[model samples]
Target: MLKREVETAYDDPPAAETVNPQGASPYMLLCEHASNYIPTRYSGLGLDAKELQRHIAWDIGVAPIARELSRRLDAPLVLSGYSRLLIDCNRPTGVASSIPEISETTAIPGNQTLSHEERAYREAAFYWPFQREVGRILDQRQAKGTPTIVFGVHSFTPVFKGFVRPWHAGILFRKAERLGHALVDALQEPGLTVAANEPYQIRDESDYTVPVHGEARGLDAVLIEIRQDLIGDRDGQMAWVERLVPALQTVAAGALARA
Candidate 1:
């Protein structure tokens, strides 16, 4: 049994925002969990402000880093405007985690028992729009013969479910192994512990952007996850931008040379 689908007007910000849309760089940055806003129509999805602010609602500090990456790299970036709680742009539509009833240990009351129509509404309003935008960008680039690298920027909590993660950052990929490993090697600073894939892994069922827009199109793509604690402020975010921009440039150049 399922609850009657909540039929609310689709309002709030647009599903996606593009920055430096015409930038010349070969990289296209994505920040899927960029916001925590659940729209007033959903009434905060039955959670208080504190819960909405948690890492479960969104990636804590990846937006600034993504914006900086877009600025420094002169690359186009696409960022989701709504919370992952409404609909995760990074996740495939049919996955349980796509509209998580329980994110981490916190139960999402609004998502507990959604009807198919409710899920479809969210997909239509939030999920599909973002996916379409990304697809359009990639398609345009392909038509122009412009080489593009898709990079998803995200942040993970230093500790999750009472477990501590040691990596300062992680580079995740499935099909773009060479570029992924190259980024891993490049990000290995003296004081930083960079992992090839830790905290989470990329899967077609679990993820959308890389698989659909990047791998499907045969473009190099990888998701970069920085520890949330490290990028919680401007100074921290800038430090990572400084570290990542060059590494990405170096790798992008190498990838082009190899192509």
Candidate 2:
């Protein structure tokens, strides 16, 4: 029998949801902060429902966008099923953000004290499964001689720490500068700003997906962040979808071809 979590989260749904695993597109998408669902046992990590709904708990509105991108691009997508507060799927375990005590302006009451067992349990229950699946899929693709580039879809609050972010979208990369700048250029439009590595930067200490899953294997990778306000509703999501698909298509072809 598997080593059960001291506190079981759910029975039916698995930790990671994989869509279109055999998708033909060279791009692979990830939405690590996809859900804001903290198990009832955690009591929303000692937060009320309203606070749980904030960006501190999740990426706000990029999950559906990623799913749609998967369908439109015929690209495989992996989504984490739990809130980042429960355990951040994109953060390396044992880091402060792995189970952040304070997310932005609000302090997470439940995370203030944690036993090693609890931390380990959360990682085992929530984090590793998603990571393993990502690794497995990439391994399979590599064996099949497929050219795969990774994109992490995320959304950030338009105003963070009281300062308004000017860029409409950010393409963050560590080693894939060529592809990153190309994507920024692709998404640029009149009265629209697409930035390269603005708002947030990808560092091994701060992130896992692009650094571990993408750069580690020498794959071209980027984390795409859209201002949360832009993708808050169906119309907004579709608009971004329309804007992103073509740019990704154009950039991925050239990025992979050059590699």
Which candidate has the highest TM-score of all? 2
Candidate 2 — number of clashing residue pairs? 0
What are the per-model C-alpha RMSD values against the true structure? 2.9, 1.4
State the local distance difference test value for candidate 1: 0.90
The TM-score obtained by model 1 is 0.95
Model 1: which ten-residue window has the lowest total lDDT? Answer: 1-10
Q: After superposing candidate 1, which stretches have Cα over 4 Å from the reference?
A: 1-11
Candidate 2 lDDT over 1-259, as tens digits, reads 2366545644635789999999989998999999988777777788998998889999988998999999999999999989999899999999998899999988999998899878888888889999999998899999999999989999988898899899889999989999999999999999998889988999999999999999999998899999999999999999999999999999988977787
lDDT of each: 0.90, 0.90
Quote the positional error of residue 135 for candidate 1 in Å: 0.6
For model 1 the local lDDT of residue 159 reads 88
What is candidate 1's lDDT per residue for 52-150, written digit by digit as tens? 988999998899999988999999999999999999999999899999999999999999899878898889878888888888888888899999999
